[model samples]
Target: MSGPVTLPAILARRAAATPHAEALVIDGVRVDYRTLHERVQSAAARMVAAGVQHGEHVGVLMGNSVDWVVLFYAAASIGAVTVPVNTRFKLDELNYCLKQGDVRVLFYVDTFLNIDYTQLLRDVEPAFDAALPGEVLPLLRRAVIVGDVAGHDARAIPAGVERFDALPDTPEWRAEAAARAQRVSPEDILLIQYTSGTTSFPKGVLLRHRNMLMNAAASALRIGVQPDDRYFSVRPFFHVAGTTMSLLVALVTGACLLSVPSFDVANVLTMLDEERCTLTSGNDTIFLMMMGHPEFRRERIHLRGGWAAAGPEIMQKIHDVMGVKYMVGAYGQSEASPNVVLNDWRDPLELRVAGWAAPHPGLEIRTVSQETGEVQPANAPGEIQVRGWSVMKGYYNKPQETAKAFSDDGWLRTGDLGVIDADGRMRMLGRLKDVFRVGGENVAPAEVEETLFSHPAVQLAQVVGVPDARLGEVAAAFVVLRPGTQASSEELIAWCKSRCANFKVPRYLQLVLSFDEIGMTGSSKVQKNKLRDYAIREFGLA
Candidate 1:
């Protein structure tokens, strides 16, 4: 039987198709499809009582949990667009997304992984303590806490904020929610994914029900997902890898999703063995950490297959050490609902390890020269471009960036160097854009440079990606201090750690005399390639 395309319809159909089947497993809680659907319905009704309207942005700032899942589905059921916040975001980053996303309602946890969100929200807007939405976040009217704040009584909760459990649930509101779900169309905007581009600020990529649902189905097809399968995914729920690739894949296929609140190598290994997980997925960093751990035993692992975004060496290691014999390669960005191309598990090991994959049905992939906009022949490297049903509508509220994202003919410019073989299998060469990935997280050099520039003693800063054994790449910095000012490399690195996410922090820092000493063009633009080469040799990273 064909499944539904929209999120709300998918949950309902899954509940009817497999009411008693285990749909989710998180934090030691096992929820079946029927129970999951019922929880979503209650949450949707509460949203209606809170005065949330259709198409309004609902921000969810929490780690992976049953509450997060329910809130996402609930928002979709009532036609509200979910704006998932990155748990790694600090105060400033969090505030930026809240304002840029135009969030009217926010559902968050008091704390997760020792990060005090209650304090973070208070820092975002001081009026949060008084329960009154402030001018800082004018669009935000309602705040809902999903769980209790540690060491705090119920009365201590903020005045304007409401507890998720306390949200009103009535028959009338539930009926209205269901009616709203029926009106949801596949073309309706489902979520606005904020991802780091080749700029200092992150841009929101608008995705529709058809874009994400179809991508999830395609990933499920490639992995040969089955109802009896247990899918373990450590990918954070805030990322498209979690939503479209893991969560929706499970929902569409009736697979039980073994969710992780936070990634712990020891805990993950224990869960894989105890849960008898049949499938799991992650980048090289995750797989390498698990295998490198002393607790990892190949005999105890039951994972048969899953997709990975890694090079050939790591793919081989995952197969040899981790025993994921059918592991396949993947390629995508947030703008394409995150899964433009993925290899089939049934393919040969050599093909699967090649880092090339077949594009999803109805998607087109080609390469064009960087210097000229002319298309390249098969097997020749060029800038990878795509166009199809999966491409995002556009970046929210950024018309110029959105226009630059596409070509004159409408192909979405991927900004990655790649090649398409005669067989139509696409393989990535390297990034044409400066944006680099650190353990599956995209890090824009401009974002890090901006953070470094905030330091008082720093006059100039340039960031680059350097090779690492554990993480695929880590940030390295070259700094030119202010006149007569002195700052140690450790001090500058520590300054960044306090200001930005861990992945964005520079692991290595070098004090340089000037940009001219490194390399500069006629326009005085710092040549990043030359700096990266210098860092590689100086740090012995090559």
Candidate 2:
């Protein structure tokens, strides 16, 4: 069924069927399927001219933009792997992602946030010159900066990167890209999303074209997407939810996607009102932002359902307040191409928040003991194991970790604890590992603790998730400050924002005098549950 349903094929078929129909609207620019498909083809040809080979990783570092979508499909058109770099990544995080993904060609905004990405690279690797593909790093040969020549710093692009418009645009190049795009197969590896794990660094989840296409189709159908729906998207394109769910779903169903560079409450409300969008898909953070905004009550907008995982009360409030009856919740990780288990919009509100989700077609789920591989009885909680077509092949270049991720018979241990009833309805309990979700983004304790440990005044640090009213959960830190070093909680909290992603920054920090204040196991691992209890009492997080 997925043989010819590749990412490029989705766009091609959509363009053929609705050549003049609206395809994407972002940053005040509207593009139709015919024009969008043409630009994607042109960009693909540029990638070919730039020497991006099949299986080669192409890094995209930019905010949500029409160009970002163009570059993504362009890379897909030529069978080059598209590696979406997190725009929030600082120098260290960005450097690691580039190296880890082994990106050969990079496309980034010329000047963003007053700092040039290429200059940042040059600061780290002074030899980072890439006038052409494979120019500087071990695998990174070329850099393409997306910008208008008339823009500031256009003439001042740090050595070796070409302007976005400088790429070839002739009919000959377009034809070449068209021919090459035709050769891309559904089984080809299309995306490498770098997601952090409980371990220190992030791993590249290798998703084939079919894995993404089917996953998007299934999830959209499960959520009851209507063909005439206009989707409002605020999530970053780097995340699977943005591309696979928001962008691809619109294409799959002939829906129009209305996007913004980032979430602005005013802009979101404006889009919701102006576009009369039938649905809006993003994390809990977006829903919270919209509901909390001052103009929230003053606005009169009608829509269907899209927000998910907000517990029962909030879900009910959204249904009543937003007038979106079908908006529902969903669950899945990046390895499963994002969503294998999804909640039905038509189901009762209680069932949705209870995590009563139906697995996608061909997706198999089982609960098993984390210590022993024994399968648990119905409704018993342990680790949730999933396997099927949507599951990724493996982590790129990390065979050992990939092997450890699955069992001998090939069940992917999801590291999450959940219960499955006899009816096959699953209730997500919590994480078996210290990893937890904060505003829908995974926050591994180690990742947050590692950033805190870098502080000079911090002797030891442990992060645990605590209940919150707005965000479903937030990271709270228990810190053992150095005896002589005097540091305020505010200072340490501010320090964390610089080192880690904004979401991973601890919201509540407790300064303790000694080790006995924390519950530690005999082997010296901090008792994570006790920390959660302490957070509730000390910070009043609950």
Candidate 3:
């Protein structure tokens, strides 16, 4: 049956249809659909009592928990936009997002992952204790702490901050929340998802309720998700892969979501085996880490299927080594509500593992020449452009960027290079901006990384272009060897040089412990832009 277009309506429908079914599972704590619905209602009422209004942004700065889920849906129910703050952000980054996102109310934890969020907030606004709304963050008035704040002398709940458990949930506020939900339209902005700022400051991508709801349902349908399925996902909720693809997928399909506050490989492997999850999701880095972990046992894992945004080698590993036979590859950015292209689980294994897939239903995908404005034919590489139900409304508060993000004809410029086959399946080449020229030879970092990944000792490889005197730009790579295995710079470069073109081989290769030294997004993506800067400094090119 075609479900409701709005999140609140879908939650209500699921609650009514399967009141006793488990909807969320975290740290052995389970929340059923009915209870989840009630919690969201109470949270929505609290939002109303706190003076949150329709169309205003409510920032969520907590880890993945029942509180995060409740606050997210609560804001949505009241027609307020949820701006999920990156949990890894420092004081400056946090300040920028809160200010740029125009967050009027914020729901955060006092402490998470050993980071003092209360102190960070104080750093963002020095007078946070003095007033409800600080001078630094003019729009932010209401601050609610969600997680445990007791039993720690250093971590005291700040003054004037409301506790999540202390929020008023009266009948009058409930009525107002329900009335607000009724007024919410599918076209209303549901989230202002901030992009991972790899190159520059992150822009808030405006996504509507319809865009997210449709994408989630489509993803769940593609994976053949069942109500009894226990889907395990370590992808953080701050990202779209976690929100629309994981959480909303569970909500729409009545499946149970297995969530974690952080990525602990040993704990995740244990949970995946103990809980007997039917489905799971992650990118290349996550899958690699799991397989490389000593605790990973293929026989113990009973996954049926899940989606990934990975390369061909990693996809193959996820299928063969990990025993996720139905693992499908996907391609997307935050601009398209994150899942523009996805592989159907029913498709052939090779196609599913090919790191290329068909576009979502009703999503129009086309390839246009980056040099020229003309469209390209099938099998020709060009800029991937999309115009569809899943495309975001625009970048929030960035009129020039929003206007530049799309073509004059209204198609969203993905800034990714890809080729659409005759069968209409798209193979992503690489990011348009990431492609570099070495002595007039164009090099896509994916092409180089693919060669490096084939090496037996290499666990993960991230390649970026670095400035050079003669060639203008040359490839620089950071290699992460398997846990017990080791590969030297000269050795891996030789392996790549033997397989790839001369210019495509990394001119400078650095062996690293992990992407942590460089930095990775919550979704496990290596920030290429940051790596590039690091390389420039390391090689003294700066």
Q: How high is the lDDT of residue 268 in model 2?
A: 83
- Model 2 agreement with the true structure over 257-280: per-residue lDDT tens digits: 889886678878988888888888
Question: Who is ahead in TM-score, 1 or 2?
Answer: 1
C-alpha lDDT of residue 104 in model 3: 92
Q: Kindly list the per-residue Cα lDDT of model 1 for residues 1-542, writing each as its tens digit.
A: 26457899988999998999999999988899999999999999999999889899999999888889999999999889999998878888899999999999999998888888888888898878876579799889988899777735768877767788888999999999999999888988999988843335678999999899999988999998999999999888888888999999999899999988877889999999999999998865567567766798998899999888766766877888788889889989889998878999999999998787999879999999976889999997788899999999999999999999999999999888888999999987656766678998877686687677667676567889988889999999998776667899999999999999999999999998767777653213466777788899999978
Q: Which of the two, 2 or 3, has more TM-score? A: 3
The local distance difference test score of model 2 is: 0.78
Q: Pull out the clashing pairs in model 1.
A: 131-160
Say which candidate scores most in lDDT: 3
Q: Which candidate gets the maximum TM-score versus the true structure?
A: 3
Candidate 2 matches the true fold with a TM-score of 0.80
> Against the hidden reference, what TM-scores do the models get?
0.82, 0.80, 0.97
Residue 485 of model 3: what lDDT? 90
